[model samples]
Every structure is written in C-alpha cells, then in structure tokens.
Target: MTFTLVVPDLRFSRQAGFNPLTEMALPGLASLLGRADRNQLGGQSAEQWLRGHFKAESAGAAALSRLVDLPAAAAGHWLRADPVHLRADRDRALLFDAGLFDISAAEAEQLLSALNSLYAADGFEFVMATPQRWYVRLPQAPDFHTTPLSVVTGQDIHPHLPGGPTALQWHRFLNEVQMLLYGHAVNDAREQAGKPPVNSVWLWGEGPEPTGLAKPCRSVRADDAQVQGLALAAGLPFRALPPAFDASGADGELVLLDTLGRSARQGDLYAWRAELERLEAAWFQPLLAAWRAGSLPRVQMILPGDEATLAASLGPAERWKIWRRPARLEECLVMGS
Candidate 1:
C-alpha cells in the first residue's frame, strides 16, 4: 500500500539562533529526507493543490466543499457561493479564515437570517453548514474569479475582491450585505458581549462542479472537510485520521497530517518546533520502523507551504543508505524557502 502524507508548513521561518533538529530527534523523518527522491510540485497553496487533485473547476473554497452534497447528475448545473470571513479592523476590513473567528452557531443563524432576508430577492440565499463554514446559492452563476482565503489572511480585502464581467454587481452586493450586517442587532449584542461581529460576507467559489473527477487513492484518511468531501464525491471510502498509525494494517490509504500549518502561518516558530517534535514521535518514528522491517512497501511525503510543495518518495532500500546522512529540518526549510 502507498501512504501519501500531506504535511503543511513542514518548513519554518529561520531565526537568529534556533535549530529544530537539536531540540527534537526525528530519525525516521531524517532518514526519509536523507535518501528519498525529491521533486517540486510547483508553487500553490495546499488548498489549490487539493482542488487540482479533485479536478475542481471553481477556485472558491465553497465550490470544492459543496461537492460533498451535490449529486453527480446535477454537478454542473449549480454554482457554489461560499461565505467570505472578514474582520472589522480599526479603519479597514481585514480578510481572514473562519478558524480565526469565534462565531457560534446561534450567532451565525441570526446573522444569516438577516442576510437571507435581504438577498432572497436577488436570487441569492445563505446557508451555514457549520459556524465556520457558510454557503450561498446563486440562481445564475456569476462570471467572476476570486483569490483563495488562505492567500489573504491578515491583509486588507479591498484589493482582493472578486473580479470578472460581473465584478461590479458582486461588489455592490457585498457593500449592501456589509451595510445590512453592520446595523443588525446581532452585531450590537456581540459588541456588548465583547465579541467580534459578523459584519460582512465574502461571496466566492462561483462556478459549476467539476466533471470526470477520478479518485487519486484507494482510501483516504483525513480530518479536513475538503478531503472528506472529495472522497464522498468520488465514491471512495474515507475515515478520520486515527490517533496512532497501525503500520500492519495500513495499505492503499492516504493520510493527511495537518499539524504544522497553523504555527507556520502565524510565524510561531516555537510552537511549530513543538508540534514537529510531537509528529516525529507519533508518525515519522513508527513509519520508519515499519519501512525498515519490510512491513511497509512505499511512503510518499508531500510537504506544502504558502508558495511551493516538496514531494519525497521513500522505500526500504533508500532508508538503508547510511552514506546519505540525515540533514537538519532547518536545512529543508531553508531550501524550500
């Protein structure tokens, strides 16, 4: 069985006097790094890579995620309208991910109700799949493209709004929604409670579902909604990533281990190092043992960051090449950066 491990931000920003490998020993990962073949998979965020893997047409996060509920026959008929998460900064609005917000389901419901009331006449409706994940359905799909939210976190959103033929209409709609939400009672209550208000919605992922998508792996194990959604859409078996790896039973499975992305994005090198050590003990160590014991046939590590991805292919023979000394994790990060 082939195991594909997707590790986001495996590389960390360099510090004046910091060495990750010195703090934690990751022999397994080091061995793989030492002998495995490396290849560059272009420059794209992890989300963009997944979209390409699933053959998704719409670049919107909503478009790819909405496929989980859409039937195959009606795939191309409807466009996915995902909610944009915005933070009300001092003077300008900041675009960020939903994970950074503290929105509750009840609060989302209240805010969405007001939005739906105003947008219903425009043939737009909002649905909150989760407090963090919101959606909107368009009567007729708009002809526009949007930047992924991952790329714009912590930056002003005015320059990154949707663009295309219907850009004017979409911008107007966003202004109207922001105005309505700004004055809603929910925002007032949130302010009183010392919470960030849901003041605006970013509409994006406006395109039809992809066609002729093929499953890349036999089975998928992941914690991400997009991975699970892609598995569902492709008619493949999927399970949540188990806390431990059972090398004896892992065959023909894809495992997505997302432990480092958050810290890397936040530029918290200390936290990034801590998480890397934990992953080293839990994953890399055991997997290396399995590969050395001939229990595992092949393992592929896909490390994705904001700009590029590094793919490493490892096998039993590669691990035994003691001449290829293990390099520090910092070295890998520096090369990638």
Candidate 2:
C-alpha cells in the first residue's frame, strides 16, 4: 500500500445538502477559535490518541482525523448563539477511506477484520477493498463545533485552507448551482403559462484541477515507480498535477468534481440535520408559500432514486431528474413571481 484516500460518502453528503467545498472549511475553525493548533487537529488534548490508533496509515488519514474538536463552550453555548451548523449528518461515526494495498484479498480481508474487531470495541467499522484500498467508518460520535457565520459582520468563521484563503468562492459556486436547479424547474412552470424561459448565470471552470493527490508521499511503502507503472497499466488517471495552488484562478469558472476523498473519522450529525433545517427555513418555506398561493409558476423538475424523498424533507417543489452527470446549469427563468 502506497497511496491512501479517506473519503466521505458523497451520496450521503449530497442527500444532506453538503458540498465538499463547504465540508473542507470546518476543521480550520478549531484553530481560529483557539481550540486547536496544527498538532492538535486530531484530539482535544492528546494528539497521540489520534495518530497511533486513529488509523494514520493512509495518505490523508492523519489529516482527516484532526478535522474537528471540542468547542470552547462545554454546553453548546457557541452553537446556540451561532446556530449555523451544516445541513447534513453532523455526527461522523464512520470514517471511510480507500487504502492501496498489494496483499492478497484474503490477507486484506483478514487485516480488515482484525482492524474492525480492534476498533469495534470503540464502535468503529472498517471496510477494505482490493488493490490495497481500505475504509474505516467510526461509529461513535465525537464532540465538535461547526463553522459559524459572523452575524454582525456577515463574515465566515472557518479556517481557510493553508494560505488563509477561505473557499467561500466554492460555496457561492455551489449556491449558484442550487439556484440554477431551482430556476430550471421554475422555467418549466412558466412554459405551461405561455411564458418566456428563465435566465441563468453561465459558469465556467477555473482554478486548479481537483486531484486527490495531497503530496508525493509513499504508497504503503511500495515502490513508487512500480506503483506508477501499475497505475498506468490499470489505466488509472493517477498523475499528480503540477501545483496549481490557486483555487481562485483567473478562469473564474467553478469546477465541480467528486469530493468524497477528504472526510474525517470523526462524526458530526448535528451539522447535517441543521443544514436541512436551515434550507427548510430559508429556501423551501418561501417556495412552498408561493406554490400555495398559486403565484408560483408550475416548476419542472427531475427526480432521482431518492431526490423526491429527500426534497420532501427539504421543502415542497416540483422536481424531476433527467440524468446525473456533469450536472450542468442551464439557465434561470424568473417568472411573474
């Protein structure tokens, strides 16, 4: 095993209205709030507890565990005052990652079984895949704080990635996607009323291409050259991109990619649930009221396997799913409403 990946279940995340961009910002809050420093990203007081047994064998495993920590307040005072948790399962009982391994399947499964058994006492579940891939889903919920938005200044309160640049641009990009999705539905509604199509914000791709490679690190202590050869043999697009470093490039187009590869072993379901609640309070409620008054145009929508069910949880809207791929933003139609 040479390269490792700790990923969040994006389906689980999408079901909860979370994008990886938003997911990437929370850990830095621990540092900003003075609750943690670089070394303290793993545990509240003891870093060894996280490093030794938190399964720091994978590439991004160590970085994943230290994502969240206990808030400054003991009794949810900060959360109560801020009330800005994510709209997904905040409780992170399961930390899932893909491990690169060269051992036999039987050997891999045996190792996975042993790890599961070892962590089972602590309510952790470990899953392993072929070719040296592994995932550890922690079952216990750890105490942590969600990133807060400053009410007074309307400022974001999460720590920025390395260069102190918060990925709010990514957040706005996702918001635009959501808005476009909603607007597309609204455009369909207006068509029935013999209305014009909606306008949409055209988005383009910019910034660094999102590659899973964190650094040129070892791949499970295997021959790096050999691993690259194997990857090429297997036709894996595994080359590390030259350091683009810039999330906000001149291109300015928002690049959306699969981001299941950077989740932590820590659980935080409260943030998940809160995000849904906020959407309900902010976006869905207004849409529903408009629908009830018949002032809202009949919106066209697409539904996926469970988007309808999930949307029901969010709020009332006419939605349908055409196809899921490179989910593109068509246009937004502002009707009479």
Candidate 3:
C-alpha cells in the first residue's frame, strides 16, 4: 500500500516578520523530506496536479465541484462564477476570495437571484450548492480559458481576466453585474455593517466536463472540491480528510491538504501558521511514524506551489541511503528572501 499527500501552500517567501514555521517542531516533515527521492511537480497548483492525475485534459473544475453536492447536475458545460470582492488600489484593483466577508446563504441567494433574474434572457443561470461555491450554467462555454481565483487573489485582477475576442464583451457584462450587486440590499447591509460587499462573480473553470477518468488511487481523502469531484467522477470511494491517518493501514490513499493554501490565498499569515501546526501534529507526524515503522510500503508527497511544485517519495529501503539525508523544512521549500 502507498500513501500520497498533496499539500499545497506550504511554500513561503523568506520575508521579514514572525516566521510561523521557524520555531515549529516538524520532525516528521523533515524526516520524510530528507529520505525521499525528490523531483519537481509539473503543475502550478494542486488542481492542476490532480487534473493530470485523472487525465482530465478538458474537464472544467467548476463542473466537477458542482457534482459533489448535486451528482445529477451533470450533462452540461459548467463554469465557476464564484463571488469575489475587487479591492481598488491606487492604480489597480486587487481581487479577494469570498471567505473575507463570510457571506450567508441568504445573501448569496439574494445576489444569485438578482443576477439570474437579470441575465435569464441571455441564457445565463446562477446556481449554488454551497454559499461559497457557485456555478453558472451557460448556454455555451466561452472561447478562452481563465486563471484560477487562487492564482490572482490579493493581486491585480485585470491582467488575469480572460483575454481574446470575448475579453471586451465579458468586461462589459461584468460591469453590468457589478451595477446590480452595488444596489442590492445585501451589499447595502454589508457596507452598513462594515464588511466588504459581494462585488463580482469570477467566471472560470471552463472546459469540457470530466470524462475518460480512471481511479488514480484506491481511495480519496481530500478537503478540496476538485479532488473530491474527480474521485466521484471516477467512481472511487471519497471522504473528507480525517484528523489523522487511519492507524489500521493505508490503501493507496491520496490526501489533499488545502487549509494552508486557502490561508495563503487569503493573505492570512497567522492562519497559515496555525494550519501548518495542526497538520504537523495530525498528518505529517503520523505519516512519518507509520512510514518509518514499515507499516506502510511507500510514501509520496507532492507540494504544489507557484513555479516548481516539490515532489518526494520514500520507502523502507530509502533509510539505508544515508547520503540523501533529511533536509531542513526551509531548505526543501522554494523561498524568497
């Protein structure tokens, strides 16, 4: 049996401040990195890595995610029209994800209703399985692809917008949507309550629906929508991440840890550190102990980040390869000073 860990947002820049990981005890993480054969994962984010795993070349993540809650919501091309706030800087508007405002189901419904009611004639419908996860059933998919929201969160959003023949048209449509959201009672209440308003819907995750999928792992344990969706689409057993590894044994389990990624996307360093600590105690340490005891046959860890995603693997035989000594957590990560 083998265990694969897909942990994103562990990469951090060597910036000046209270480094959350500097003093943290991470013997398991360190040992695992030290003994494993290391390589660079090809994709930029966890979603890309998982996509390649399932050979889902044209599968839009939006559709896959929607299927988790509404398994029957398949059969059409779907887009992730996630709600976001575009914060205006001096020269550019920085994008922020939905978690910032803690939008309620009622608020999400109010906003989604207004957009659907206004754009129904244009063949656009807004639907939500969860308040934070929204989808758009378009009459047809757009011509171009879009960057994931996590890619540009807390950064300038204009440059990341879909570019091509439809760019200008989308811009206009978004502006109209913004106008509607601006006058909505939800935003009015949010503003009065001193919170960011739901300003725009980030339309992305466009492509073909998931097809030709095969089980990459025996079982799937992840907290990510795309991962869970892929597992379901492929007919693999799926479950949310447990607090710790199943002590009985692992059977080709693939775990995706994204709490760190979410905090990173939201620019919450404190939360990132806290999550790192939690995973260390719950996941990393336990996996390392199990692997060392030969309870597991193999261990593989993939850290998906910006340019170079870190990949490492180890087995009992690796313990004899003293030359490949364990590395410091900072050394294993691609950091900026």
Best by lDDT: 3
lDDT of 2 by residue, 1-337 (tens): 1112111122232324433333332221111112111111211111111122222222222122112121121221111111111221243211111211123456445444544454468565544323233333434222232221111111222231112143454345335433443345444554566643322111111122112432322221112222332233222333432122122121111111112112212234454434434433443344334433444333111111111111011112322221312111110000110
Q: Each model's TM-score?
A: 0.86, 0.17, 0.93
Error of 3 at 286 (Å): 0.9
What overall lDDT goes with each candidate model?
Answer: 0.70, 0.26, 0.81
Give the range of the ten consecutive residues with the poorest summed lDDT in model 2: 328-337
- Candidate 1 off by > 4 Å: 12-24, 54-63, 69-92, 335-337
* Model with the higher TM-score, candidate 1 or 2: 1
Q: lDDT by residue for model 1 over 100-125, one digit each (tens)? A: 65778888898888888887896776
Q: By TM-score, how accurate is candidate 3?
A: 0.93
lDDT of 2 at 267: 32
Candidate 1: minimum summed lDDT over ten consecutive residues — where?
A: 71-80
Clashes of each: 2, 48, 1
For candidate 1, list the clashing residue pairs, or say none.
Answer: 1-252, 84-202
Order candidates by TM-score, high to low. 3, 1, 2
